[model samples]
Target: MSTTWITRAETAADIPTVHTINAAAFETGAEADLVDALRTDPSWIPGLSIVATDRHDRPIGHALLTRCHIGTVPALCLAPVAVLPEYQKTGAGSAAIHTALRSAADLGEHFVVVLGHPAYYPRFGFTRASTHGIGLTIEVPDEALMALTLDPEHPLPAGIVHYAAPFGI
Candidate 1:
């Protein structure tokens, strides 16, 4: 297991590998199918989908950020982050997520929301979404729903999250 991995925005050529990573990481194909649906959805943001690769340049982890809203304000949603079974706990997923968030910030994206592990997400500066007045239309564990302000100047907006249509929320 190499400690160092390369991260980059996903390309068309990487799609199949990315899908494989997601499908392998989760118990079901739902996450993988969601990725496919999001690609054609209006919420898709081109550069926000990112992957982490091993030395041989095979994608071993994937992360995605797509358009969602907190109330009427624009925001990004982070979902279905996946690392290949062999790559779990190797920091490949973290590298992919960090790279994707940085790319989102670079693109002038302000806030991001993720429904994920409370313990894991906070290391990336994520806090309880409810603390910042952010909620979801769909019920989820309060601690699991995290929010981050990519830019310090822009605070996390307060409201219910409106996820993309394919999310079925």
Candidate 2:
């Protein structure tokens, strides 16, 4: 029961464990299936998928970033963050997300968008996407759609987010 989590880029061996974590964290397996689909999609960015491991070095949480666009400008889409049911509220999910975002930044990715819980994403520097003229094709709560700029020099672009094909958005 340690609070510390080891985060890293997901490896091929971790796929099954990541899928299991996603399936168990959500009420349905759609998120898990989406992850699998994204893996083979052209939008897949290597080293953007992250995992948080327990003391035993077993992956208990996951986060993924994939290529997307803001209008025609390249960006990233963060979705399907998942943690094991027993590990929820223990910061595993947060750790995985932070690592994923950091990894993206290290790879020179500048902008990221996430459609998720307002409260949760804001902690990671995500602000209302609408404020920047960012939106989705489909309707969603204003607060749920947020964006972040990894580099202050490059402001978040304003436009409709074009997510990967797996997202079906």
Candidate 3:
């Protein structure tokens, strides 16, 4: 780990650049737009949205964990994870993801789901959510829906995921 690359809880000051990073990293504006909507809702869990900052403290990467549900059980949803185009493959995104997951675990969040690259997410301890009988209401690639039990004492819940209101899922 590079000491120069700092991972910190996002402050209001970092929101704009973090959004910019997301917009630049993705082909479409959906992720950046989703982050904007999340900030306005009751579901925004402070400290769950974290940033990886450069030495000068400018955000170059971001990872957000927001409230969701597996049946009636509360869980977290990881989405729109992004790093600046130049920072991809350099571990900036990984650092932000790790920091966010650690914070979620510390907050006693029991489970988290992500629809992402199958290979990449497993490196973070995510497994096939279907094996646990968890799925989404919307259609998606089977291998892309993954989950992680942040608190091993509480096994992942099983049911169709209902994302926060702001997510429109």
Candidate 4:
């Protein structure tokens, strides 16, 4: 397998493949279902859903960023990042996430929050959200909830994360 991955904004035709990737990556279909629900939700931001493809341009990993809020301030939520089980640990998911975050920055988005593995997300600049006074409505491990600022000029806002309805947070 090539170490390099091609990352790009997900197209309509890539949706089913993305779903399959998510379903296969996780323990259940909930993550895939959440991605499907978020697709039609108002929070869905075009071009923020990204995919990593193999040499033949077949999508093997996916990442999605959706509209959310920190208190009343607008932000983005990174969720359900998935890679094919066979592709796990091959940098496919990381490539898709990096691309999605870059796309968000290019679109002038500032803050992003993710509830994920503390060790995995920090490489993407995510830090313990509670350190910045960021939290969630529901209880989660302080380390599991992380936040990042795409632009250092605009520091991460401190508030409770209000995820999109589909997240059911």
Worst 10 residues of 2 by lDDT: 1-10
Runs of candidate 2 with Cα error greater than 4 angstroms are none
Candidate 4: tens digits of C-alpha lDDT, residues 21-77: 999999999999999999999999999999999999999999999999999999999
Which ten residues in a row are the worst by lDDT in model 4?
133-142
Candidate 4 colliding pairs: none
How well does candidate 3 score on lDDT at residue 97? Answer: 91
Q: What is the lDDT of residue 41 in candidate 1?
A: 99
Query: What are the per-residue Cα lDDT tens digits for candidate 3 across 1-74?
Result: 24446899989888889889989999998889999999988778999999998888888989999998898889
C-alpha lDDT values of all predictions? 0.94, 0.95, 0.90, 0.95
Comparison by lDDT, 1 against 4, better one:
4
lDDT by residue for model 2 over 1-169, one digit each (tens)? 7689999999999999999999999999999999999999999999999999998889999999999999999999998899999999899999999999999999999999999999889999999999999999999999999999999999998999999999999
lDDT tens readout by residue for model 1, 1-169: 8989899999999999989999999999999999999999999999999999999989999999999999999999999799999889999999999999999999999999999999999999999999999998777999999999999999888999999999999
* Candidate 3 to truth, TM: 0.96
Tell me which of candidates 3 and 4 scores higher on lDDT: 4
The reply for model 1, stretches above 4 Å from the true place, is none
Evaluate residue 25 in candidate 1 and report its C-alpha lDDT on the 0 to 100 scale: 96
Q: Worst ten-residue run, lDDT, model 3?
A: 1-10
